[model samples]
Target chain A: MTRVVARVIVTPKPVVNDPQGITVKQGLATLGFREVEDVRVGKYIEVSMEAESMHEARERVDAMCRQLLANHIIEDFHFEVDQVLHRDTHR
Target chain B: MTRVVARVIVTPKPVVNDPQGITVKQGLATLGFREVEDVRVGKYIEVSMEAESMHEARERVDAMCRQLLANHIIEDFHFEVDQVLHRDTHR
Candidate 1:
């Protein structure tokens, strides 16, 4: 089996209100970072899996993201799948 | 002024206990994703800023991450800074 690592990023839809992002933007302003604008907060998920190939790994990770990693109603998810070397395997 | 977008990813240190990750891993197992392993949860933050140059923008975002976006004690943060096109500006 091939060991693969998937980095998934889940972000709120543009129309959705991101209270956390707003709070952070305000915090930045308070810190004298007035130049900062349009801050968006999201979730980053890393999944390591054993698959037959990179294609299979990507498909499985995509399914995982859609099923649990992200709420499709308000969030959009994207991911990158890469084969892991023996030295890079966490387990 | 240059419009730049910074994507920051924050993950817990390897030594830190991530309850969220453990929970997710359990969920995956229950869902019959036995091939999955070492699931980690983290935060992804995107910040758009106006600066004089790309170098300045990167420095500012790095400061922002260090000051408020990430807790250095238990987390490690990395970011990618890129120039934003006119059409990509959120505001």
Candidate 2:
């Protein structure tokens, strides 16, 4: 079996409000980083698994995101099939 | 002034425990994605603002990461200075 690693990123839809991002921006301002104009927070998921081929891996990951990883109503989701390599260890 | 947009990604150090990731993996398994071997969760931040120049933008962003965006003790952070463009609106 090939080791397939992928990344799924979830972010709030532009039309939706992000309290966390606003809070973080406020925090940055308190820390004296007033130059920062805007900030939006998101989730980055790294997945490692076995797959028959890259095609299958991409298909499965897309399904996983739709079924479980992201909330389609309020959030936007995207992913990349990064690698089908051996013994990768970068965290 | 140049408007520089940057992205900072912060993930737990490999040695650190990620309870959220573990929970998400369990959730995925419950949803029938048993082949997923491991999952690590991280933060993705999109920042938009003005900067004097590209070089200064990168430097300031690096400092911002070290200062407030990431907890360096338990998290590993990296970023890319994506664009120094004008009137960008993609979130």
Candidate 3:
């Protein structure tokens, strides 16, 4: 099996209300950061999985995101999958 | 001024408690994501700053993290600073 890394970014769609993100942006502005713009808050999850191939890993990671990591009603998730060397199989 | 980007990853120190991360890990396991391990949850803040230089940008980003983005009592933050092409100066 090959070790794969999936980096998932879960964010509320643009149309959706994100008070948390808005609040953060406002806070930045209050802190004298006027040049800052387009602040959107999201979840970043990095999952390392052992799968036979990239396709299988992507499918499994997608399932994991749908079932656990993200709420489809308010959030959308995007991921990038990469193969990594298995430095420590014993751990 | 130059436009710079800072990617900050904030996570609880290893010795600190992370109940939320632990709960999420358990949830993933319950969903049959058996390969998942060592789940650490944190905030990823991407800041776009217009500063006189890279050193100034880093200082401002560091201050932002200390004042608002991170709770130093429980979390540690690491950031990567980059320069991005400004395609829309008007916007």
Candidate 4:
């Protein structure tokens, strides 16, 4: 089994009120930033795992999110899984 | 000026207790995931901005963080600024 990295982002739905996100966006606008938009705030999860394939890695991460990483009633989560390349050090 | 993307991740220092991260890590282990470790929880900020240079873009984002994106007393933040690639369509 090889190491895999999963980056999970959890955010509120568009219809849901994101007070934290809004607060951050408003703050940005105050700092002379005019072009910022859709400033949604979310969580990032970095997990190193050993999985045989990308599909399996994703499945494992999906289960992790549903069970604990995110509060399903009010939030949604998405993740990207990739294999970790270990560099060989023999020259 | 070109568009820039900033991905900011804010997390508590390692010495600080991270209940959310610990909970997720434990949950993963329970589901037969043994290789996961140091699962830190953070935030991702995707900002589309027009900046003249990387230094200027970073300066703007740093100001944003100090003003709002992260709480200075409880959390520390790090960000990556990259020029956004916009594909022009002409046939």
Q: Highest lDDT: give the candidate number.
A: 1
What does candidate 1's lDDT look like per residue over A1-91, in tens digits? 9988899999998999999999999999999999987899999989988999998898888889878889999999899998888845452
DockQ of each: 0.87, 0.87, 0.48, 0.45
Docking class of 2: high
Ten contiguous residues with the weakest lDDT in model 3 chain B:
B82-91
lDDT of 4 at B10: 77
Q: Give the TM-score of each candidate.
A: 0.95, 0.94, 0.76, 0.67
Model 3, CA-based lDDT = 0.78
What is candidate 4's CAPRI-style docking category based on DockQ? Answer: acceptable
Instruction: List model 3 lDDT by residue over B14-52, tens digit each.
Output: 678777778877888888988876566677776766888
Clashing residue pairs in candidate 1, if any?
A: none
What is the TM-score (0 to 1) of candidate 3? 0.76
* Model 4, position B2: C-alpha lDDT score: 65
Q: For model 1, what is the error of residue A53's alpha carbon versus the real structure, in angstroms, after optimal superposition? A: 0.6
Q: How much lDDT does candidate 1 score?
A: 0.90
TM-scores (chain A) of the candidates: 0.94, 0.91, 0.89, 0.84
Clashes of each: 0, 0, 0, 0
Indicate the DockQ of the complex predicted as candidate 2: 0.87
Please give the range of 10 consecutive residues that has the lowest summed lDDT in model 3 chain A: A82-91
Q: What's the best-to-worst order under TM-score?
A: 1, 2, 3, 4
